[model samples]
Target: MEVEKARVLIVGAGGVGIMAAYALEVGGKAAVTLVMRSNYRRAQDAGISIDSVDHGKGIREWRPTEIRNTIPDVSQEGIPPFDFILVTTKNIPDVPPTVADLVAPAVSPGHTAIVLSQNGLNIERPLLARFPQNPILSSVSMISTTETSPAVVVHDFADAQKIGPFVPQPAAEAAARRYVAVYNGSGRLADVVYDADVPRARWHKLVYNASFNPVAAALRMDTARMRMSRHVVDDLVRPIMLEVVAAARAAGHVLPPDLPDALIRVDPVEAAFRPSMCQDADKGNLMEIETIVGEPLREGEARGVPMPTLRTVYGILKGLQLQTKVAKGLWEPAFDDDNPYR
Candidate 1:
């Protein structure tokens, strides 16, 4: 009897990362290691859970290991390099910046394929120059999920799909074996397509993210409200979709001719879902504006396409950041002793 031959490293131990780990680990077919920030101690107590379409496909308990901490810099003491790497970090640019500095020293292009389970547009093109030889892939999800607590999550919605560049001619054999290796052994993933229209697949997700995220965060509203309101749909939502479509077109993305129709598809009354931007804002963390809305709008303007709606939303989000800052008081405190941000 032969065992599956692959070593795996997951860059995040957040909800998505741990879910994938459980999928891989229960199959008992792959070696899995998760790299997360030290703050994941919070996750340990939170009680996270995931349910798949198939029975016996849920992670009951997760005792995750921290890949590295105490030193923001990479250390050579432990952690063997792996054959496959899954980057499940936030879509913010800082994540990739940090990953490059931390993981690159231990990882090499040889036998390493990375799957970027991130959101936003144009994330792939930026990494090409440095990891030119490594097979880089992208994935998106329609399900609304959250890292409820380190230990548990209530998966409100569950739609997991992955699509990537057709594992180039050179690494086709290795990549496919590894792709099949995960789902075939684990039974946690499906609808994994490796072919053309991948960019379209990516942009399709961008449309969904942009439509719900900014509106929800800016209005401090939830998915259900935005989906239910005509004011949000006509005034705020549709315009943002237009800007997103413009940006996608400017970037040479292929989309249906009825781009607006494709971009703005929300349930008549939004599902019991919370947008990531809303979640991030509620947590008082840095939101993914720069990549999701800000960057695409800028890209469109740079390419002579107009994204007024996007620009407006970017401005509003920035103002909200300022309001948050003021409330938190990074400035000289009016009340020096107990400044909120302090």
Candidate 2:
């Protein structure tokens, strides 16, 4: 008897999505299908170019087990039910067609496992609310990879995936373990640990993400420049991170006292690194403000914690996002309150 491979559908073909697809395909235990939209033609015609530090160098034109321009509907011919649906897109909740809607067509109730490999805080709530029976694996990815261009990915720094179940039921735990096993089969990844407390892991990671990502975008600075700016790091970044720490603690996820310092002091190798939010801002795309900064702030405030610094940053990013949306014509500007146009 021959063993069957796990059929996996990756919904987003961004940097983290492509990286996940590559790792799964290279692992050889699963068949990975990547859904590409914008770069679909580029990926099909030229193939995805990988310049990865972990998976070795000079590997050009890499394709997954399968690539579809759109998410595969279960009714589609020759498309098998996917065991895992990985969503690696940015967690921008203000946008329409929520992530739940994007992956709902292919989701097999109580069977298809959902994995969120994106950024932000408290991101699992919407999915859990929509797909009540399915296993939700909330993952915090600690990798410095970027889609430099269409169909091109550059992974320079560490790559680690800390995932766990949202509810921690038997099915959820099993899904978490199986996903870890499949991902670990690659044997090249630095770390792919199954976290017992995924929410805590999320809060801990947010200490770095909620601080550096938006601040970097706001200042238009890379990791090196942010570090070089004594006032910026000391005054703005450090205080924001402390606020996150307080919020996490308020929410019952007690993080280490020195964790902020640990993340603030990045390795010299990752000096030129820019966060995803910064990249999004640079490309004139909508920044992920609400989920990354808003949700946690709300959670903290509800619990009587004051996040003054984080609140200020969130307000600034929200204003910037408003301007970006108006420029893109996704939103209309309302200047005068009494104007009919407003």
Candidate 3:
């Protein structure tokens, strides 16, 4: 008898999600299904095309074992439960249909592991609160892929990921190990690794996400343009990164003191790469300001650590979000007669 393959469902079909599905398919260890929201029609009709550096250039018109548009469709009666449900969507809790709601139906208590492959800090809180009995695997990815258009992906660089149990319970740890094995069984396309301390890993990634990501959006510049200016590095980027280190230390996740400098040294100085938030702002989409900046800032303040740089950037990004809302006609500005400026 043929052994049964592990079933996996990916919630977001962006560049990261597509690459993840590709990795799983290449391994042939599991049956992969992708939930495409924005490009469902295109993906269902034309399939996904990948221009990859790691998987080579011949991955045109690729589809996972299943293509789904909603979680409910996959959670229907008689279908086998997913062994893993990876949420690769951008972490914008401010938006409707919280990630908790989006992935709740497919969760199989004590069976399915919830994997988060997105950015930001404290992103697993809601999932933990909702599924106290299930395992929540937090991950930090180092892939460089982009969705230039609908159903099209450009995989330029590394496809690595480090995942760990969020709650660290026995069940959660086992889930993390299993996921690492499944993800890397096909020669480690995602280069999966297990991290015992995912929180510390989150803080390390935030040193860049909290600093360069927001700054890129606020300044309307890419990574190369921002790195071009010595003043920007010395004044804004370095300061914010240092503040993040301090904040992380205050939150009991002490990162390496040289982390900021090391990250700067390895940053692609010449690539005109746009971080996720920069791309969101350019498209007038909601950014993960609260999770990336607000949550850490609050964590610091609760511990009496001052984060003026983060606070200032948070305020600016909030204003930018408001601008986006107004442009989309989802929000209206109000004038108060008591205020002279109004």
Candidate 4:
């Protein structure tokens, strides 16, 4: 007869989260609710305005079924538990209230599948530890999008969104495939792919993110400028990318040998785009240094693979993060002989 609309709760109101919400609502496949801490009021007032080249000229505005400031707010309002909890926030483990903590309240075991649409490696560790019985899905987005204002977002380009089960359980895989169907049926904005090799897909994306994201933040330049400089590409970008491949191999995920070269040759049209890490740095927001760079470096070290380039870039980005905090008066520099980078 009729199909039931899947209920999805998006935990973050950033670019990715907003984009996912827009896609789901537009597709009519899910009843979406967004937990936007800062933009709840604005989103409720004006809805979300998406200026997307992928979606074309007119600004697409969508109001989810409800927008609440927090998970507790949803519970207080008597909203039902979400069928899926999609986390599109940055993977900052050191930050208080980890992803697991944020989605714990609304998670229904066996019913709710936690989808982590984030960058970096081993991101599902905490969630797996916290909710051992729940189905966890790892997702990687190739789309370029940015939230320009409280209620306005800009989508530059979208290549694909790959998803797979984090733990390889049948229930988890089924859940992941169902989520994929929703996106693929939704005008193919993401060009969703059911990646069987989750680790390889993660490492493949890491080859690009681990190399460019930190470098862009450290150098304070966009991708176009970074790619334009041969010295930067050869000396910095390519080196870091190779290190990622090495690290991935050491961690038992062997990526393509030519992946680094392919990543360095940025498409001229999307060249001007700044990665999320660089955008976060520009706004004095904390970058995902530990997750995006540090975790892989640690993995390599554990596997006896030396990632000198990744290590150096990780240190630089961490130092930049500390500087941003100090400038914001959130942290004070300690006058000690010990090197914080070390």
Per-candidate clash tally: 9, 0, 0, 0
Model 1 agreement with the true structure over 163-208: per-residue lDDT tens digits: 4643345473456456545633655555443444556666666676
TM-score of each: 0.79, 0.94, 0.93, 0.91
Instruction: Determine which window of 10 residues in candidate 2 has minimal summed lDDT.
Output: 266-275
Per-residue lDDT tens digits of candidate 4, residues 79-150? Answer: 676788999887787666788988888887657899999888888999999888888998888887877788
For candidate 3, the lDDT comes to 0.86
Ranking by lDDT: 2, 3, 4, 1
Alpha-carbon runs more than 4 Å astray in model 2: 76-78, 267-270, 335-342
Listing every candidate in turn, what is its Cα RMSD in Å to the true structure after a full C-alpha superposition? 5.6, 2.2, 2.3, 2.8
- By the TM-score metric, which is better: model 1 or model 3? 3
Extract clashing residue pairs from model 1.
43-150, 46-149, 47-151, 47-152, 48-151, 48-152, 48-153, 49-153, 328-341
Off by over 4 Å in 1: 36-59, 62-75, 78-80, 94-97, 166-169, 172-177, 257-272, 322-342
Query: In terms of lDDT, which candidate is stronger, 1 or 4?
Result: 4
Off by over 4 Å in 4: 53-56, 59-61, 72-78, 187-190, 269-271, 328-330, 334-342
Please report how far candidate 3 places residue 139 from its true position, in Å: 1.1
Q: How far is 241's C-alpha from truth in model 2 (Å)?
A: 0.7
Q: Report, for every candidate in turn, its global Cα lDDT versus the true structure.
A: 0.63, 0.86, 0.86, 0.82
lDDT of 2 by residue, 6-107 (tens): 889999888888888888888888899899988889999989999887887677888988899877788665556889999988778898878999899889
Q: Model 4 residue 200 lDDT?
A: 80
Task: Give the least accurate 10-residue stretch of model 3, judged by summed lDDT.
Answer: 70-79
Instruction: Report the C-alpha lDDT of model 3 over 120-178, residue by residue, as the tens digit.
Output: 77888999999887899988998889888998999998788889998878899998998
| lDDT of residue 232 for candidate 1 | 85
